[model samples]
Target: MTELPFATTRKLGLVIDLDTCVGCHACVVSCKGWNTENYGVPLSDQDPFGATPSGTFLNRVHSYEVQPDHGAAQLIHFPKSCLHCEDAPCVTVCPTGASYKRAEDGIVLVNEEACIGCSLCAWACPYGARELDQAAGVMKKCTLCVDRIYNENLPEEDRVPACVRTCPSGARHFGDLGDAESDVSVLVAKRGGFDLMPEQGTKPVNKYLPPRLKDVAPQIDILAPFLEPVSKGPKGFLGWLDRALSALPGEDR
Candidate 1:
């Protein structure tokens, strides 16, 4: 049995801003392009350019419709990938030691050679980050561009995750979550960043900046009542954490 680490020395991950994401597929495209050849095994592909396109990518963007308490309905572009939890359930659940989280930088990865494609990791992850590669017959997830980030051959400025580099809107950020003074951490503090499904106890290193609703001017009219979000009841513990961290405005937050 593989023993898990009680605590990671450093946690590195991405911070996605819902307020700025434009739903552009640039991150998705750039990830696929860079990772395809960087790793020995090219990511599997299936009719990527065809009318019905399909392919493997480390990063993905999804759109959701939400009516905030501030104003009218809105479309939120959500970018999701491996959160690289401090205590990754997927790594703990790997039967064949295929999944492991690095201690030095807290990047979770899979040893494809040891993976049996049992899919236990997939079942263990609540974020839907893991995917089975039909071509390799193994489970794979985001590696946070580990190869590029650490490659000495690449120029320092070019050593960020492909997704982060290609994000035209600068909605995606990458940094060390373990370092309290890191830019990403400062942003989280000021913008009220939060973990996804914190109740699940993954303690996801990645944080998401909530949508800034202040941009939409609050209206005082009968129609505003209908637009008020029913889901605005209570933000749960994450909300409390946000308040404790700082009192950033809803829009700037």
Candidate 2:
């Protein structure tokens, strides 16, 4: 049997910092814009301007409110995308061999020409990464901006993936995960990075470093002023209306 090509273990992946991510959807929008034009079929929207507009997207950012202390909440924004696993379940489950990890860079990609429109690969992915392009009748997911990265026409600094390039908060970093000395590797080491849904044993290459929290107590007096009642001024019509509304009940008013 031929040995699995360890020669091509470059493991190109992303390291997303949870601390710096400011819940901006720039990465999501940038991804949609780039993939829509370059990917096999555009990420089509059904009635884009109408009610209940929906479209296919390879990456999505989720905002979660985490309350670590009493009356204190931190908004955590997670940019969810393909992890590009070393032991990718999606690749193994593909009947057509369309979903394969690139030998050159270890990036998993769907060969649109070879794909049989089977959704098995999508089902195998634990991260919910694969999206079916209804228009093309094939599966699509993040290519890590393969074409853009390799394009010589683009500037050297601008050659990274769209999501990483467009992140205003500097939350996303793309580099060779296989290189132990890489910046991403160092960041992962220093920050105690973790992979999402590791219990599935997919061995995801990408990592998410949790937000670091300081133990300092928040100043309570800052909130006290907002809680105090405002003294009523000379009663104009609007002021009378406000007083009447405020009198009608809830403590918040």
- lDDT, candidate 2, 26-59, per-residue tens: 9989999998988677887767899887778899
Residue pairs with backbone overlap in model 2: none
Candidate 1 per-residue lDDT over residues 45-162, each given as its tens digit: 8777788876666778999999767657889999999999886899999989878988788899998889899999999999999888868788878889999899899999778899
Task: Give the CA lDDT, 0 to 100, for residue 116 in model 1.
Answer: 93
TM-score of each: 0.82, 0.83
**Model 1 regions lying over 4 Å from their true place:** 49-52, 216-253
**TM-score quality measure for candidate 2:** 0.83
**Candidate number with greatest TM-score:** 2
TM-score, candidate number 1? 0.82
